[model samples]
Target: MLIIPAEKSLDWKNPPWMTLALMLACLVIFVFYQGKDPRLLHTAVQHYLDQGLDRLEAPIYETYLEREIRLEGEADRRTDLEAFRETVAAGERASLAVTMLMDRPFFDYLLANRDLLMNGRQRQYWTEARVPIQQNLINEISAYEAGLVPAEPSLYTLVSYQFLHGGWGHLIGNLVFLFLLGFTVEKALGPGRYLLAYLMCGVFSALIYTGFSWGSKIPLVGASGSISGLMGMYVAFFGMRRIRFFYFLGVYFNYFRAPALAILPVWIGKELYDYWAAGSTGIAYMAHAGGLVAGAGLILLLGKGWFQAREAFHEPEQEEQDRQFTHDYADAMEALARMDFTLARKRFEALWRDYPDRPVVLEHLYQLAKLRPDLAEYRQRTRELLNQYLKLQQPDNLLRTWQEYLELGEAIHPLEAEEHNRVLFAALRQDDLKVAEKAFARVRDTGHRELVREAGRLLADEFGKRRMEPKANEYRLLLKTL
Candidate 1:
């Protein structure tokens, strides 16, 4: 699930300078600096294998994993350890070497057992190979100085870590949240204050993460913490004021108006739940939570009035009208789901009468009208929806509507060949032979002889592929007659 402020659109006249700079910086670094990560990682891992580092470290790492599995006895980590072992046994030399090569904790483990793992020649050779990879490769982009290492936090790392990202997906995800929240936050706080607040939030986010995972060697790198800060500020600056938010529930999506503060608890609660439930998932949930709290706190301390609304934002011209319609549409759908046909019909017809542009409203009204087929509304609605189905470009919805219309025994009064041919073409475009056959059969006796023949030809080929040769020949005979 994802939720974001949808109250404002970008305005070219008044731009968010600090926000754009931050986005550009992240993009530039990813394209230029972190762009080298893939090559550097490949070269380092290849060298590790070329120097036979795997043979020495593989056994030691296996021993280390076994000890951890036995000592910790956690179900999840045990699964991970077993999976890691499978990679080792599969002779995935590059992948196998990379675990120890990039992982600081494994490096420390190897250091602690240097004499136990390697003889003099092996030890000297491994050391000679390791130094360059650590200094020139890892230290360049993923340098311990740039990534936030909880075991060894510094003022420098706390601020700098927000600029590094683990992968393209990671950078892109942060970039989206950065833009969504950053533009408004920067506008509210001004460029200087926004930059300062962003770094400060990052600092606090790291501190909280360190407090939870102290002495852990994993280096956390990403702008999630700072983006989370902007989220907090977005809520605080708006406070009890209502704003539009776009939300997704896996499959369907919609926008809702709610007090900005109403979403903060949900955001923080999700992070808190993830912090405890997904402690080993490598995502710093605590840091995200910390950033949220810090951003809100800073905004509150400065006073809400100090931050202003985005005057340059492009609010939708139809927003006020759409809000009421959005609610009514949801209510009408709910009535339909509840099988309250009377209520559903009334509400949808009202919407159709008022908003003739809403094609979906016609679809629902047609569904209701079919039940009362003895009435004039049934034919009126059938003709209305058939026109809409032909004009609309959504093939999936069109096919479904036609299927439902046929199953419901719907027919247009004085059926027109042009409409039938259009529906047949639409169905054929989707390769929906079922609807195409039904629609073509309606227009086959009419003057649309060429269309019938072409459609029959396509149908014959489709049936041939399905190995229904008799059905294929039936259409072939029809094409010959046409």
Candidate 2:
């Protein structure tokens, strides 16, 4: 089953650069520093192959083989050991040697016996060879330092760990969640506080992970902890609002809207179930649960007006106004449907007066004007609606208004020069020379010197293409004067 949140209740005016930077930082670290380096593992494999098993110290070899038996089990260990012996007997080609060592079972065999391969009689020959392989196995020296190891907790790892990820899939999954929930949280908390809260949530998550996995050496990494916190905050802030979600269950697919907070318990409950049912599968479900608890608590405190002077609350005035507009707009549309022109006009006018900035209200007004063009008030309303469309800079509305103007035989005097140019260009593209000519003339009359010059040049080009030298020359003269 696949379930994902669709959209949030809030809108952001600007792009979230801080969140973007964090993602970029993770990518840079993974690609440039960790993934690109190939020295250690490759070198160690090459060295072991060149020296051969006869050079190996006996005591170290026996101890190493025992460790391999314990780790990989006897049957798998025997299989890999035989493969290594066969590769050695077959003239030990460098390519075949590297391949054998790279295989997981064979790699573990070589790692366990690294000390035997590097020391005593072969010390000079294998010193550099053994160093890289042993270090790579024991330390995960290049990459794992950035992750938070609960067994050996560090203050630095608590925050830096969130920026590190296990693999491309891990990074991508975390980034997707972060973008969905982070932007909304940033918008709600504001940027500075949002960054602080994100880091704090990561720290809290790590603490929870440490408590749960105190004896485990595996390092916890990724941004899921901080992102979980954002989800928790989302529930606290917009719990009552119905939010749409897209869900897929095998072949079945559908969308449903539910109260925002309703998903929180489901998420936490799933994590709890997974934690117990799956045993330790490497995922830090405890950290996710901890982040959720921390975020909900923090947001609740902020709601009580503790963190900042301003309390986080919904705008009742705006909500009420929206509700009223929806009610009135529907009534106006219903009146128009019944062909009660007088009643529709009055209702639309009331809507226009109350919601001057609403594009839908102006649209309905324009529709009403088309129905009763004989009325002076209706004609005037058409002009007002056209002007409003221009102000809004909506291309569809501008084109519709232009069509309505032509149909009504109204002079396009009030249309802005930019919109007039757009109409001219659109007409030219359609090869509607008559409409283009009319639009160009209207734009020329506006006395926008630059637009008039541009129109003259375009007309000149069109005429020249048609082999009308005289008309083209006339426009060229007009352009030169401009």
Candidate 3:
């Protein structure tokens, strides 16, 4: 299941540079910097093997495991220790070297006994290989050095960890939320304030995680906590205003309108529930919950006094354009109903100027023109009405309009050749023989040469389809000369 606010009408006129910069920073770090992790890890492991540090450490680890097993008093842990001894005996020391090196407790044990375990030359190899690998490639690599470690939390890592990711999946998942949720919050708070809010949320999330996981070496990474904070800010920024939300429940999905602040509890509850219920999922749900609350708290502290209302979540209660058109159209019709021809024409002409394609405007204006042909607008109005009618895609309807225009006035001119081409093709498609034959003649005389030939071929096929063999033969024979 997933849910999010379906807001953010992008205005390219004002680009969200902060949001874009944050995204670009994460992408560059992941692609060019963190992308080198696999190779670096391989080098570290290779260094451990080349130094033959495993041979020296393996028995020490074995003895440590043996002693630990008796004190550990857990069957599963004892089995694991016995399995470690079997792996060492099987001579898979290269892989085992990494485990032993990363094992901080065992490394401390090995350090305590290093003098007894190795000669001076062996200690030289250990120092040469292990130090560089452990510092740069193992624990001090990109995720660790910069990422938030609850055991050793600092201001630098609290902020820096938001940029590091464990893998591509982790980076992409967090970024999608950032883009979907960030732009609106940035727009709402404006960039300067939004950046401050975002970092503050991240810092607060790290602080919360530190409280939960105190004195642990594992480094927490990813932008999820910051993204979660944006989620919180989204709710608190908008307050009680109704906003559209999109939700997906596996096979089904839809959009609905609800108060913006209503979803905050659901978000916080889900995060806390997942943290307590799902056991250890490698996800920092507590950080997410903390970020959510912190984000809202920041808004509560500084939002109302700081900024105007939220533009991001606001939806139009009524369409201004459609409402205005209806009101203006009704006013015009009311003037016409009172038989105020002068006022009616004025209203209609204005409507026509704005809404040129309104059929009722054409019908009434044409009638008014007939009553006052002395205005000398009848010819132009007739031509305009006929042109608009021709735009109707239905050929039958166009033919009916053509018939009405002809019946409209004997003095009215037929449409120009380019315009007549539309009628000619419409007549052909609909098999209106009387109109098609006359149109065929007009186009043959004044229409485009290529268009005339193309229409001639179609006219011939249309004739054959009608079983008018003699007429089909006549046009088909004429095409040979053309």
Candidate 4:
């Protein structure tokens, strides 16, 4: 199952540099630093393995002696104990075959030292005991040196760990989410606070993971924990706003529009379920949960008013454009109110040219077109307004605007025939004969057979009832031709 937030909760005038930089940094670290050297890692693993094995030798020997002394009382067990002792004395490193001969106590001891022995053997095999390892040791060195090991938590690893990822998929997945959620948080919190919050959440995530997986030697890496925090911030910031989301479950996919806060429980529940069902599947769900909690808590403490205040700082260019749009819109409205067609037309034209997407500009322009005596410009502006409304993809606005367009007696394009037919059908159902008649006339020659037949039938029935014989007969003949 996959769920992605569709609409950006907040819009930014300029590029979100903090979000972009974070993503780029992750990519660069993965591609350049982490992917550079395999041998160095192998060597480092070998080195640690050898060191660990040396530390375990005394414990292994002590356990062996204890087991030998215990087995000496039994004649049959004496032979096994002697054989085990010989194998150990032969300086042969622990192998699966040798470990199999061990009793419960000895086997447990062997298991305790398994990591060191296995790593040592793997390193030795890969390195062939060769001297002068290559210069590319960054990847190997970074894992333990920079990456967070839950058993050995440190201040530096808390931040550095977020940047390290296990593979390409890990890196890409985290980066994608980071960008999706981070930019919104940045837009709300401002760059400085956003960066600080991100790092703190990451640190908290690491701390949470460490608490859960205490003494675990495996290195915890990736930005998921921090991004989870951003998700939390998102929920806190725009939780009440209805946000659209695209969801997929295997072959089935659909969209849902719900309050942004609704996603929080879903995310948290999924993480909790996965964490329990799939024990330690390399994902630090706890860290994600922790980050989410931290982010949400931080936002709550800062209060909603803080976010509103931060939003006041917009890019200068966007602010200037907004100011200009307001000034021009007001001027145009004033001119229209004064019935100064020349000045009003000029201002409306400039507004439309500058802000084509502004629905209000189209509405005013359409109004201006109606007041002026220029039939050609009136028709042109009416078409433009209709087209803009269609492009907006707002169903309610489209219906309202289309009704106005029909009332104005302007032509609609063939491309809009299907939608126009729907509006016509709605108008007819509502018993608005005038609008229905106007819409039918516009779509009559568009070659929409079913729509034309339906319109002809409706128009004929209505006209026949009104005792309009000529109009009724014309519609009947039109239907027969179809």
TM-score of each: 0.62, 0.55, 0.59, 0.50
Alpha carbon lDDT of each predicted model: 0.80, 0.70, 0.78, 0.70
Clashing pairs in 3: none
Candidate 3, superposed: residue stretches over 4 Å from native: 54-129, 307-482
- State the displacement of the C-alpha of residue 104, model 2, in Å, after optimal TM-score superposition: 16
lDDT tens digits, residues 1-482, model 1?
88888776665577988899999998897788777778888887887778787787777777777787778654555766777788977877777777778777778876677777789988787678876777777666564647888899888899888999888898898998899888878767778878988988989988998998898878888889888888888888778989989999989999999999889989999999987787578788999999999888888887445444445332343565599789999999999999999999999989988788889899888878878776678767776787776676776766666566555554544346666677788887887788888888877766778777776887898889989999999998877775
Question: Which structure is stronger by TM-score: 1 or 4?
Answer: 1
TM-score: the better of candidates 2 and 3 = 3
- Candidate 4: minimum summed lDDT over ten consecutive residues — where? 129-138
**66-128, model 2: which lDDT tens digit per residue?**
666787454435554555556657755664545443433333445565565555656654445
Q: How much is the lDDT of residue 466 in candidate 4?
A: 84
Steric overlap count per candidate: 0, 0, 0, 0
Candidate 2: regions farther than 4 A off: 9-13, 36-39, 44-142, 304-327, 332-356, 359-482
Top of the candidates by TM-score: 1
For candidate 2, report its TM-score: 0.55
Q: In lDDT terms, which candidate is top?
A: 1
